[model samples]
Target: MSRQVKGVVSMRKGAPVELRTVVVPDPGPGEVTVDVKACGVCHTDFHYREGGINDDFPFLLGHEAAGVVAEVGPGVSNVAPGDYVVLNWRAVCGLCRACRRGRPWYCFDTANATQKMTLEDGTELSPALGIGAFLETTLVAAGQCTKVDPAAPPEVAGLLGCGVMAGLGAATNTGEVGRGDSVAVIGCGGVGGAAIAGARLAGAARIIAVDLDDRKLELATTLGATHTVNSGRTDAVTAIQELTGGFGADVVIDAVGRPETWKQAFYARDLAGTVVLVGVPTPEMTLEIPLLDVFGRGGKLKSSWYGDCLPERDFPMLIDLYLQGRLPLETFVSEKIALTDVEAAFEAMKRGDVLRSVVML
Candidate 1:
């Protein structure tokens, strides 16, 4: 049966989001309908509205979400009705080239809901990250709904669906942080702080948090950063080097994604050490580095797309860790807001007032 759901919609580029009732078609094949309990406002949502990600409009914004699986389509066996699950953007296709190579985490072709949700006017809505959840419910590929420990709050587990997971994956998965390794993460926001926490969880010897704001830096310390660098006051590259015994950290994560921060991350790592670019930069900005430096640096320079994560592999494991009291994933939430407060929350984010403003339905 078809369903109607109330969702937040961006009618046009650079315009305010409108809350309206949308028509959600019943899942067709390999899809599931999720009764979204909580969704987080992410920068990607803003980017979609600003036309940075694509020109697809009007968009159904909001992706980071957790919910109860209310229905599943034919051929779906990963989840069942009434399962408490986290909604993930990436639904790995086991047959993708990346998957064929045995690295499912790099799955090249992901899946989404086969049925389209549309506005009242019958205009098709492009879901933000393909799992729009700033609504009563949303539809996604069944594989995107990963069943985790049902005891965890939807608000907390939902965050692991996006930014939080990206940050943690940047450190633990892409960066491959290990015991006795020294790491530095630039931009102490939600994703960056998660990298710090992941570094600690992986038993990194030193974790350096870099940011202009002292408040965020303080939060980084709470997230297991061993040292803090106020980049606004001091040279970030120099600070990282000094903190890591003058050789620079083994891994330097650029969570800010600006050309400036990317450069800082490049030089803030030791020779042959990795520099993980988890931050998203605007298209207008360009990165420039000397060819000699590229050759001289024997290590890898890679970009992390959703932390190169495969939802099926990581989501449940992380939730179990979170439930065990080992991972303080909940610390990333700054405030819980209603759906209507998303606009104001975006303003607060622009002013650097909060880490994340989650919409608790």
Candidate 2:
């Protein structure tokens, strides 16, 4: 039987999302249905609303979520009904070349529900990140649901599904930020802040946070930054260099993803130091840098996809840390909202007012 539930959907480009009846079909083979407890409003959801992601109209726009398995289809054994799980976009297929190489984090074949969720009129809807979580119930590939510690609150645990995981992974996994190293993170948004926290967890000797907004820089400090640089008022590269005793940081993370920020990250690192780019850039933007500089940098320049996260490993470890008070995941939940408030939450994100405004379903 099909289920009708309320969901936040983007019907057209640049239009506000509307709460409408979303039709979810019963799970098919290897699929599971989630009873969404909480879903966070992320900038990617806003991008989908603006048609920045694609022409996939009527997108079901929430991905960062924590929920329980309400039902499972035939042949599904990864999770069962009543199990608490954190939804992940990357449902790795073990047979993929990337997985075959023992790097499942770079899984070339991720999974999603084979069937589509739609409207009453039968218009097929694209789920954001292949896990449309803003609805009361959503269907996904069984592998997308990774069971985590049930003791943590949904509002906090759900963030590991995306931004938070991205930042932490950029630093810990992609950048290889190490103990006693000097690290600087450009752009103190949710992802950047998480990078700072990750650096702290890695025992970085110094952590510098750069941001255009003072409020964001201040918040970054609470996460683990040793120093804050207001790029709006200072030359970011020079400031970072000065803070690092003129040697530059050992690792610099470009969480902003803009060309200028990337340039700063490229120049603000020591020779052979890593520069991690975790931010999502638009297709129209072009990066033009001197070829000689790239050769001279002589270090790893990498991009982090989903923070190079293996959901089964990272999510559980992070949830355990959060429960133990070692990781302060609570700071990321700026507000709790209803499904209808997603459009407004987008505005708050645009204005840099909230890290996340999660929908409690």
Tens digits of per-residue lDDT, candidate 2, 1-361, equal 9899999999999988899999999999999999999998988888888887898898998999999999999999989999999999999999999999999999999999999999989999999999999999999999999999899989999999999999999999888888999999999989999999999999999999999999899899899999999998999999999998997899999998889999999999998888999988876778999999999879888999989999999999999999889999999999999998888888889899987899998
The lDDT of each candidate is 0.91, 0.93
Candidate 1 has which clashing residue pairs, if any?
none
**Residue range with the least summed lDDT across 10 consecutive positions in model 1:** 304-313
Runs of candidate 2 with Cα error greater than 4 angstroms are none
Per-model TM-score, in order, reads 0.98, 0.99
Candidate 1 per-residue lDDT over residues 313-353, each given as its tens digit:
78888988989999987888899999888888888887889
Tell me the alpha-carbon RMSD of every candidate: 0.9, 0.7
Candidate whose TM-score is highest:
2
